[model samples]
Target chain A: MLILTCPYCGVDCDETELGAGGEAHLKRHGPGSTDEEFESYIFQRENPRGVHFERWRHAMGCGKWFHAARDTATLEVFGTYVAQAFEPPQEIKDKITAKRPGWTWRDVA
Target chain B: MSDVVTALDGATFNGTIAVEDAGLTGMITLRGDFASTSFQNAVTGVSGVNFPGKGEVNSVGDRGLAWMSPDELLMIVPYDQTNAALAEITENLGEEHHLAVNVSDARAVFRLRGNGNVIREVLAKLTPADLRVAALPTGRVRRTRLSQVPAAFWFSAEDEATLICFRSVAEYVFGLLRQSAAEGSEIGYF
Candidate 1:
């Protein structure tokens, strides 16, 4: 029942109209990487109880893929952004820090 | 070539609201940079309407321009003139990196009429979209699920809405709409 706005179509789509794409910002370690690196890349993912970033597709709407940052614990959405972006925008990161108070994800705070 | 027949062969059902297969509608799926002047010009040249804002559908007669996404627009034209209109835009676009394909045959269009804004109630039964007049008034199009199928609809008038879905599921959508609009099914939430 979570309403997440699609960055592409600008529709506030609920969970039913969207398809979840697991964790976001995955970096693939290819053939040249060590076994552990490949294993971590293929299997490891952050499951923090607080703020998290994830991918969602507007399956019933514009058929576009986008990303959303939300709190896992409170279910409050921080923001949504385009999938093509490599990382969260400065403003969204700032918003996350402002509300969560000392919250940091990877090297991005 | 052959005489064109819509998916439901112009089926009509008179429930709480009038549901009818709108026969054949020419739809062109055009994908390109909406910011491109060339794209804008070619679209307006054929559809005779300005680029609509996000979620807006600017339609006149058989020609309409609807914002389907950030980089995509759905052009509605007369069924008989789909090829010509597609050709016109493709030629006008020239070397622009774009895609203009005829989707007329792949989709079914439905018209829901009557009951004085109760049409919104009928549609609300099928979709999760906020069907309140303020949320989905005339000129605004919503792409969402009609129960289990993906459908897009817009209000052409306060008492009427036009719905479009894949041709393969035309019958399913029609059944869903007909049932939603069945007598005594009216739920005045709009």
Candidate 2:
């Protein structure tokens, strides 16, 4: 029963009203790249227990996509931002850092 | 040309709240940035009702508009004036980046009327959205799931509301409303 507010519609929606779009902000490696690069791009994912960023679609509401930064274990949603953002805003990162201290985002972020 | 017809042909159901098809309403889906003067002026210039704020619906009698999304508006006009209004909106927008299309026949509208909290109770059954008077007061619109289907509804009066859904799901939504509003189904939570 996780709830996330849609940055686009400004409505707080439960998981039932939204569809998860998997991990967000993945760098795609296209043709000419090495086989390992392509493989990592397609299959690799971070399964951290703490603060994670993901894409979600407000399927039942405004029918728009947005990003959510939350804890994978506790389900505490730190913040939601527009889908077009290349990365989560500084405020979201700060919130995550404040909630889960020592969670380095330099590599993951 | 064939005469236009509503999906349910003016269906009606009487329960705790009266639910009935609102007949054919001229609807246009206008998608564009509200920040643009041409976008704002074009729609307001033809819709009678000015551009509404987030999740707001501005309607007076036979005409109005609903804020459908961050960049979309649903213009409600007389059934006969949809195309004309769309044409006028397009002309006004000129070369602006926008989309205005006649969507009157692609959807269905319904009216629910009752006293005090009955309308709210009837709607609270199907969706997770807060439908209390204070949250969804008259002139405000909410777009959310009505059961498993996507729908949008607006409170026109304290005791009356209008709902809109895709034409294909008119019967499904009508049935859900009927069952939720059944005489013995009052939840009294609102």
lDDT of 1 by residue, B111-143 (tens): 989965788888878788888777887999999
lDDT of 1: 0.89
* Reference-based lDDT, residue B142, model 2: 84
Per-residue lDDT over A52-77 for candidate 2, one digit per residue giving the tens place of the 0 to 100 score:
88999999878899999888889988
User: Model 1, A1-109: lDDT tens per residue?
Assistant: 6889999877789789999998878888998999999998988888899999999999988888898999999999999999998889988898898899998776667
C-alpha positional error of residue B5 in candidate 2 after TM-score superposition, expressed in Å: 2.0
By summed lDDT, the worst window of 10 consecutive residues in model 2 chain B runs over B128-137
lDDT of 2 by residue, B119-150 (tens): 88888899988777777788888888999999
TM-score of each: 0.96, 0.95
The runs of at least 3 residues in candidate 1 whose Cα sits more than 4 Å from the true structure, single-residue gaps closed, are none
DockQ of all candidate complexes = 0.75, 0.66
- Top candidate when judged by lDDT against the true structure: 1
Against the reference, the lDDT scores of all candidates come to: 0.89, 0.87
Question: DockQ winner among the candidates?
Answer: 1
